[model samples]
Target: MFWTGPLVTALILQFISLGGGQNNDPDVLLESSFPPAEPSLMNLNAICLHGSGRARYPASFFPPSGYAYARRAGKAVNRLEAWFSQCCYEEGAKGHGQILCCAKQAWEAALSHFCTEEFSTMTMAHECCQQRGEDRWNCFAKQAPNPSYQSLPGYLAPEVPPDRIVFTWDPYTC
Candidate 1:
């Protein structure tokens, strides 16, 4: 778990390292707001969830000033992750390492969803949208929906033990 603690801290730092900081709320920072869904589950519930779970603090949240909003939002996410790490660590209890691992797994999973090649391409679209109108582009500049506790592939998916995979909670006892 100690490994996980440093690993998460490092990841968060790395995320922040990629961009400059802009004052914003970090707690509300979310990688993606889209919930995971099965291809077969295209039902009303899924649609409803999809509509309701759109990204928070989307680029639309900013004024139609310029790309400053996107830059600022990115920075805010970094700051949020940093703050989340500090606060969660403080409240991580006796098994702080385990908690770190959980958070790390969650973060990695979240990153995986948004930082993919497809997502990278979206950057171009976002930029183009910005050119069209910062206000309009803001609508497109949103983080993907967050991965749920049960939907994190790295954590929730079955895998071999003893390897560097996510740890699950044992229900029988603490």
Candidate 2:
């Protein structure tokens, strides 16, 4: 069920060692916000789940601001997977327009929250975090890895166990 605590915090720290996990609302749950979807159905290896999914980045961008941003950016894919189950498959919004819009929204919100957290600790936030609206999305879009969702050689997605890392989710400023 993925309780929201030790699982994520430990995953983040553990993933780095090996290696990691979010949310807000004391009584509300981000997990409950969307339907559950298996990671297999999610093309978890990809940075973006739509289009050619083509986007790459350079190093020094905070784990180069790409998939490895946080536990190979697992949470980003986690949210997208849930949205896909809820919006694309469950709701049957499979058209290009529907899926594209869903992916963009999912991508934006996931990255925005990532940036919000990233902004909190950095003396200078990542360049992508400095952007707002489409700019930020575009910047993140440019760094999408495995955009095609094709499996990376020798790379396997990790099994999500239990507990989730809790984030403050407080608004952060650069």
The candidate maximizing TM-score is: 2
lDDT of each: 0.32, 0.39
Clashing pairs in 1: 32-144, 32-145, 32-146, 33-144, 33-145, 34-145, 60-138
Provide backbone clash counts, one per model: 7, 10
Task: Look at candidate 2 and tell me the lDDT of residue 115.
Answer: 73
Q: Candidate 2 lDDT, tens digit per residue, 92-152? A: 4455555445555555555666676667663566577798877866665555433334422
Give lDDT: candidate 2, residue 54: 19
Worst 10-residue lDDT window for candidate 2 reads: 19-28
Task: Kindly provide the TM-score of model 2 when superposed on the true structure, using C-alpha atoms.
Answer: 0.46
**Lowest lDDT block of 10, candidate 1:** 152-161
